[model samples]
Target: MLRITATATISLTVGAILATAGFLWADRAFPPPLPARLEASTEVLDRDGLLLRAFATPQGRWRLRTDLASVDPKLIEMLITYEDKRFRQHRGVDAFAILRAGWQLVSNGRIVSGGSTVSMQLARLMEPRDARSLGAKFRQIFRALQLERRLTKDEILTRYLTLAPYGGNLEGVRAAALAYFGKEPKRLSVSETALLVALPQLPERRRPDRNVEGARAARDRVLNRMVSAGLLSEREAARAAAEAIPERRLALPAYAPHLAETALRNAPSATAHRLTISRPVQSGLEAVALNAATRLGPKLSVAMVMADARTGEILGSVGSADFFSTGRAGWIDMTRIVRSPGSTLKPFIYGLAMEQGLVAQETLVEDRPSDFSGYRPRNFDMRYQGDVSVRQALQMSLNVPAITLLDAVGPARLAARFRRAGVMPQLPPGESPGLAIGLGGVGLSLRDLVQLYTGLADGGRAHLLRDGTELIEPSTASTDVLEPQAAWQIADILSGVKPPHGATQRGIAYKTGTSYGYRDAWSIGFDGRHVLGVWVGRADGGAVAGLAGYVAAAPILFEAFARSGLALQPMRRPPAGAIRARRADLPVTLARFAPGADGLTAAPNAPSEPPPQIIFPPAGAHIDLAEGTAAPLAMKLQGGRAPFRWLANGKAIAGLHRTRTATWQPDGAGYSTLTVVDAAGRAASVSIFVE
Candidate 1:
C-alpha cells in the first residue's frame, strides 16, 4: 500500500510538470498579438501643462495618453476596490474571485459578477473580441498572463487607463475627463472621481451626457462599493452619491489653433508638443480679438500676438477672429500673411534717425506737400502740418515727416535694420526700399512688425520670436536694432501719446498704422517686458473705407492688454545720455533738421542770402526765469531776409516781425528751442534751458 501511494504521488508530480511545460510552449508559440505601439492623439500643452489644443487620431478617436501620476489618487483607489480587489496580488486572473463567481453563478443560476482582473480588462482592451463565451474569457486570461510578464504593474494600469472606452470616440481617462468635466484628471472631486471610475463599464449606456440617470446610478454603485471596501466612509459615500452628473459634455480646449497647427506641421511624428503659450492669456486675447472683429464688420478679420520682449517667447497668438467663419475667410492665418504695413514702419525710421544723431525729439522737420523724385507723399488727411517738431510728426503719424526722415536715413538702411532683427519686408519685384516704404508701400506680416518692436521694448536688443517648434534650446543671441539711448528716446515719446478714445491709459508705448486705401489697420504696443501686435482688415485685401488704425485697431490693442491678465510692466528707465531736451536746448545743427541735397530743391531764380543765425540766448545757454510767472526771453538773430518767422519748438510766435529782435514767453521750460526762418526759407536755431 505504501509503494502504491508513493507511485501515485510521483505520477501526479510528473503530470504537473508536463502541464507547466505545455503552457510555456503555447505561450511562446502563440504570443498574444499585443500591439507594438499605441496611437494617441496629438496634444499641444501650455507651459503649465494645461491643454491648449488637441488633434484627433487618424481613426477619428480621442485617445489621449494617460500617465498614472496625472490621474487623481481617489479614482484609482475606488476603481480597484470596485473592479478587482485582488488586482495587486494576482498575476493576471484571480483564483479566489473566479471560484467565488462560479459558486455564485451555480447557486443563483446566473452570472452575478465578473471574475476578470484589471489586467484581464487591459488585455481585452488591447485586443478586442466580440464573443462573450467561455472561449473569449480563456483568451483574455491567456493574454493577461502574457501582459503581466512583459510589463510592470504601473505600466499595465496606465495602458488600461489609456485604452478604456468612455462613449463615442473618447478613449482614455484624460479624454473622458476633459470632455465631461472640461478639466484635466489631475485634480478631481470625489463625485467626479466616482463618475470617471465607473464609466468604462457599459460606457455608452452609462454616459452622463446621454443618460444622466444611468450614469448617476453607476457612479452611486462605485461610491457604495468604496464604502463597503472601507476606502470611503458612509457619510462620504452618500455625499458623493448626492452630487449631480454632467448632463452635457463640454468641448475640449481649442486655443491658438493656428499656432497649434504650425507646431504639428513642424513636428509631424511628435505625439505631444509643448509650447510657451499661457492658456489663460491665450483665451483672454482670443476673446478680445473675436469681439473686436465682430464689432468691426462681417467681412473683416482680426489677428493678434503677445510676446515677452526680453525672451521672445510668444505668450498668446490669435491667427484670426474666428477659425470657422466663412465670411471673414478665417481659415487664413492673417498674422503671417503679407500685407501693407502702413505707418507701422515709421517708428523704426525715426529710431534710425535718432541713432544717427540726425534729429532730436524737438528738432523742427518740414511736413509740407513734397515730391521725392516725382513720387509725391501726402499725409492721410491729404493735409500737412508745416514745420512740425520731430516728436509731433511721429506722435501724429504724419506721412510726409516720416518719408522725409526715411529719405534722410535711406530706406535701404531701414530695411537692413529690419533684416538684422530677422524681419524682411516684402517689396515690389524690381523696387528697392523707397520713400513710399515708409508709408505702407512695403508688405509685411503682423509678426514681422511685432518682432521689430521688440527691440524698442528691450532697449534696442531684438530677440527671435519662438513658439517652441525649434528643437534647439531657446537662444539668448540678439540683434542690435538701435542704440540703447535711441531706443529709450523712442519709447519715451510713444508712452506720452494719448490712448484711443474711450480706452483707459495703460502707460504703454504704442504706434498705429493705416495702409493705403484703408485696406489694413495695425497697432503695436509694448511695455518693458511684453509686446502685443494687432491687425484688422478684410482678408480678401478689399478696402474698408475710413478704417484707420487709431480708430479700428488701437482700441482693440488696449482692450487686449487689459484682458491679458498680466500686470502692465513699467517701461524701462532712460539709458545713459538719453534725455528729453527742448528744441532750444538742442545743438545748433540739431535744432532744425536740414534735409540732404537730394531732399531739398532750391527756389527757382531766388536771391541767395546768408543763413539766419541766433544771436541772443546762444546755443546751450541756460537762463533762470522768475518763479510762478510767465517770463519772456529776448531772442535775436542776424542776417537773412526779413518778415522773419520766430518759432519756439516748431510753433510760430504770434506774429511775423520785420525786426530780427523779438520777445517770446517761455512755456515754463526746462529746455527750449528758439528758431527764426527767413523769408527765403533759410533758418537758424538755438537751444536753451530756463529754470
Candidate 2:
C-alpha cells in the first residue's frame, strides 16, 4: 500500500511540473498584442496652449492623448475604488476576490461581481475578446500577468485611462470630458467624477445621450460604492447623485480653421502643432468678419489678417467670413489668393519716389489727364484736381499723380523693391512691369500687401510673417522696403486720410484701394505695433457694383481694429531727416515734382509763358499766426501773366490779381497750400504750415 501511494504522489508532482512549464511557455509564445504605439487625435494649439482645432484619428475615433498627470485625482480614486478594489496591491489578479466570486456564483446559481483587476481589464482592452468563456478568462489571466511583469502600476493605469471607451467614437478620459462636460479632465466635480468613472463599464448602453436613466443609475451606483468604500462621505454622495447628467455631447473647439489647416499641411507628421496666433484675437476677428459679410449681402466674402510688426507673428488670420458657408466659397483662403490690388500699391510707389528724393510731402504734382507712354490713369471720380500738392494727391488717392511717380521711378524698380520685401506681384506672363501696375494692374494677395506695409510700420525693415510650421527657424534678417524718412512720410500722409463714414478714427494710418471694375476692395492699416489688412469681394473675382475701397473696406478695417481686443498703439515719432515741410521750405528742385524729362512735359510747340512761381513764404515755410485770433499770412509770387488767381488747398483764396503779393487770414493751425494760376494756365504752388 505504501509503495502504491508513493507512485501516485510521484505521478501527481510530475504532472503539476509539466502543467506549470506548459503555461509559462504558452504565456511567452502567445504574449498579448500590446498596442505598439497608441494613436491619438492631432491637435492645433494657439500660443497660449489653448485648442484651436483637433483632427480625428485614422479610425475616426475621438481619442485625445491623456496621462495621469492631466487627469483629476478624485476621478482616479473613485475609478479604482469602484472598478477594482485591490487595484493598488495586486500584481495582476486578486485570488481572494476570485474565490469570493466563485463562492457567490455557486451559492446564488448565477454570476456575481467580476474578479478582474485593473491590470486584467487593461490587458483585455489591449487585446479585445468577444467570447466570455473559460478559455478567454484564462487567456486574460495570462496576459494580465505578462503586463504586470513588463509595466509599472502607473503605466498600466494610464493605458487603461487612455483606451477605455466612454461612448460612441469617444475613447480616453480627455475626449470623454471634453464631449460631456465641455471642458478638460483636469478638474471634475463629485458628480462629474462619478459619471466618468461609471461610463467605461458599459459605454454604449450607459451613454447619457441615448439612455439618460441608465446612465444616471450607473452613476448613482458608482457614488454609492464610493461612499461605502470611504472615498466619499454620505452627504457628498447624495448631493452628487442629485446632479443631472448631460443629455447630449458638445462639440470640441474649432478656431482659425484655415490657419489650422495650413499648419497641418506644413507638418503632416506632427501630433501637435503650435502657432503664434492669439485665440481671443482670432475669435473676435472671426465674429466681426461674419457679421460684416452677412450685412454685405450674398456672395460677398471678407478676409482679414492682423500681425505684430515687431515680431512678424500673425495674431489673427481670418480666411473667409465663414468656412462652412457654400454661397461664399468659404473654403478658399482669400488672404493668399492673388487678385488685383487697386490703389493699395500707391503708397509703396510714393515711398520709393520719396526715398529717391524725387518728391516731398508738400511738393506740387499735376493730377490732370496725362498719358504715360500709352497708359493714361484717371481719377476714381473721373474728374481732375489739375495742380495739387503731393500730400493732397496721395490723401485723395488720385491715380494720375501716382502714375506720374511710377513713371519716373520706373516700374521695374518698383517691382524689384517688392521682391526685396519678399513679395512678388504677379504680372501677366511675358509682360514686363508697366505704368499700369501703379493702378491695380498687378496681382497680389491681401497678405502680400500687409507684408509690404509692415515695413511702413516698423521703420523700413519688413519682417517675415510666420504662423509657425516652417521647417526653418524664424529669421532675424530685415529687408529694406523703404528708407526710414520715406516710410515716415508715407505713414503721415495715410494717417491724415479721413476715416469712412460712421467709423471712429482710432489714430491708425491706413490706405484704401479699389481694383479695376470694382472686383476687389481693400483697406490696410497700421499703428505703432500692429498692422491689419482687410479684403472684401467675391472669391471668384467677379465684380461687385459700388465696391469702392473707401466705402466697402475702410469701415471693416476700423471695426476690426476696435474688435481685435488690442490696445491702439500710437505711431512712432518721425525718424531723423523726416519732417513735414511746406513747398516753400523745400529745395527749389523738390519744391515741385517735375516727373523728369522722361515724364510729362509742356505741350509740343506750345508757346511758353514763364510759369507762375511762389516766391514769398517760399515752398515749405512755417509762419506764426496768433492762436484764437484772425492773423493774415503774407504770400508773394513771380514771373506769371497778369490776372493771377490765388487758391488755398484747392479753394479760391482771392480773385485774379496783377500784383505779385497778397494777404489771407489763416483758418486753422496746420498745414495749408497756397497756389497762384496765371491767365495763360501757368500755375505755381507753395505749402505752408500755420502755427
Candidate 3:
C-alpha cells in the first residue's frame, strides 16, 4: 500500500512539473499584448515642453504620457501608501494583503477591502474587463504576472499613473492635475496631490466637474489614509482636506493652433511634437490679435507672424484673430494666403536700386505725376510731393518714385531676387512684368513678406524660417538677395520712418501697405532681433472702405512688438558703401533722376497723349454741399495724360497735378464748372451748381 501511494505521488508531482514547463514555454513562444499605454495622446508643445495644444487619443480619451520623473513625488508616496503598501516587495500580487482581506470578509460575512496591487490595477486598465467576476480577476492576475516579468517597478508605476482613470475622458494624472488645477503635475499642493491620488479609485463617483461633494469626500478619505499610514501628520491632513476643490474642468493651452495643426499633420505618426514657439510670447501675441480684431470692424480678421531674425526660427504665429468663429472664416490660415502686397514691396525696390548704385538715400527723385507706358502710378493721397529726396519719397510711400526705381531695376530681376531669398510673389496669371508691381500689383502672403524683411534684418542674407525642424545654416554665398550695404541702407531708411502713436520710441523699421480697393492691409517690420508681419482685412476678397495699412494694421504691429517679450536688438551697423550723405554728395549719375531716364515720361519729341476728362460733377448739374467746411467735393477724372491740370471755376487748384482724384473746396452756394486739362492741351469740362 505504501509503495502504491509513493508511485501515485511521484506521478502527480511529475504531472505538475510538466504543466509548469508547458506554461513557461508558452510564455516564451507567444508575444504579450501590446500595452494600450503606448497609445498616448498626441501633443504639440513649445520649446520648453509646455503644452501648446493636445489632441484626443484614438479612443477619445486624454491619455497623456506620464512617468515617475515628471509627476510629483509626494503623490507617488501617497498613492503607494493608500493603494498597495507592499507594492515594492510583492512580485505581482500582495499575498499578505489578500489573506487579510479574505480573513476580514469571512469574519464579517461581506467584502471589505480589495487586495489588488497597483500592478494588478494597471493590468486591468491596459486590458479592460467587461464584468467584475472571478474570471476577470484571473485574467488580471495573469497580465500582472506578465507585466512584472517584462517591466521594471518604475515602469509599472508609470503605466498606472498614465492609464489610471481620472473621471470622464481623462485617463492620466497629468490630465487630472491640469483639468483640476489648471497647471502641470510637476508642482502640486498637499490638497491637490491627495485629490489626485484618490480620483482614480472611483473617478466617476468623485469627479469634481459632476460631483463636487463626493470629490471632497474622496479627497478627505485620501488625506485620512495618508495620516494613518504615517506618511502625513493629522494636522497636515486636516489642513489639506480644507483646501477647495475645483468644481469645473479647465481648457488646455491652445496657443499657436494653426502651427500645432500643421506640425501634427506633418508628423502624423508622432505622439508629441515640440515647436520653437515661446509660450509667453505666443500667448501675449494671441491676446493682442484677439483684441485687435475685436476693435476692428465685424467680419474682419487679423493674422500675424513673428520670427527670430538671427536664427530664422518662427517664434509666434497667429493664424487668424479667431480660430472658431465661422462668421469671419477664421479657420482659414491667412498667413499662407496670397494677396496683393500693395506698397509693402516698395522697400525692396529701393533696396535693389541701392544695390545697383543707381540711387542714394538723399538722391532727388520726382514724385510728380508720372507714367510708365499706360501704367500711371500716383501717391496714396493722389497728390505729388514733387522732387523729394529718395528717403522722403520712400518714407511717405510715394508710388511714382518707387515705380521709377523699379523701372530702372527691372521687375523680373526683383522677382528673381525674392525667389532666391525663398519668397515667391505671385503675379497675375499670364501677365508680363510691369512697373505696377512696384505699387502693390503682385501677390504675397504675410509669410513671404516676413521672409523678405528678415533678410534685411539679417544683414542682407535671407534664411528660411525654422518650423520646429532641424536648423539650417545660413549661406554666405553671393546668393544673398541684397548686398550688406544695400540691406543696411534700407534698414536705416525704414528705422527713420515714424512709428504709430505711443510707439515712437520703438526702434523698429516698419512698412505698411494698403492694397488697391482696400481689400488687404499689411504691416511688416523688423528690429535687430525679430521680424514681424501683420495682415487685417476680410477673408473673402471684398473692399472695406477706410481700410488702410497704417490705420488698420500698423497699430497691431507695434502692439505685438511691445507685447512679444523679446528685447529689441539694435540694427546692425552700416556696411561699406552705405552713406547718409546729402543729395549733392551722391554721384552725379545717382543724384537726380531725370524725367525720361526712368521711362516715366514720353520720349523726347514723341507725340503727346490726349488730355484728361473730368468725370465727376457732370456738366450743368446742381449739387447741395454736405455738412462740415472740411468736406471737399471729390473730383474724379478719366483718360488722363501726364501732369493733368485741374481748374475749379477757372481757378487752378494749388495741389492738383497728374492724378485721377482731386478734392476741391467749393465756395458757398455758387455755380461751378470743373475742368481738367492735360499738359498736352487735351481738355474736358464739367459744370454744376452748389447750394
Best by lDDT: 1
Candidate 2 Cα outliers beyond 4 Å, as residue runs: 1-24, 103-112, 187-189, 227-244, 263-267, 386-388, 471-476, 582-590, 598-691
Q: Which structure among the candidates has the greatest TM-score?
A: 1
**Of candidates 3 and 1, the better by lDDT:** 1
**Rank order (by TM-score, best first):** 1, 3, 2
Global lDDT of each candidate = 0.86, 0.85, 0.82
Residue pairs clashing, model 3: 342-440
Better of 2 and 3 by lDDT: 2
lDDT of 2 by residue, 414-499 (tens): 99999998899898899999999998999999888888889999887798888886777778577979766678889999999999
Candidate 3 TM-score, true structure as reference? 0.80
Q: Lowest summed-lDDT stretch of 10 residues in model 2? A: 598-607
Q: In model 3, what lDDT does residue 366 have?
A: 83
What is the Cα-based TM-score of model 1?
0.85
Candidate 3: Cα lDDT at 476: 33
Model 2 global lDDT (CA atoms, 0 to 1): 0.85
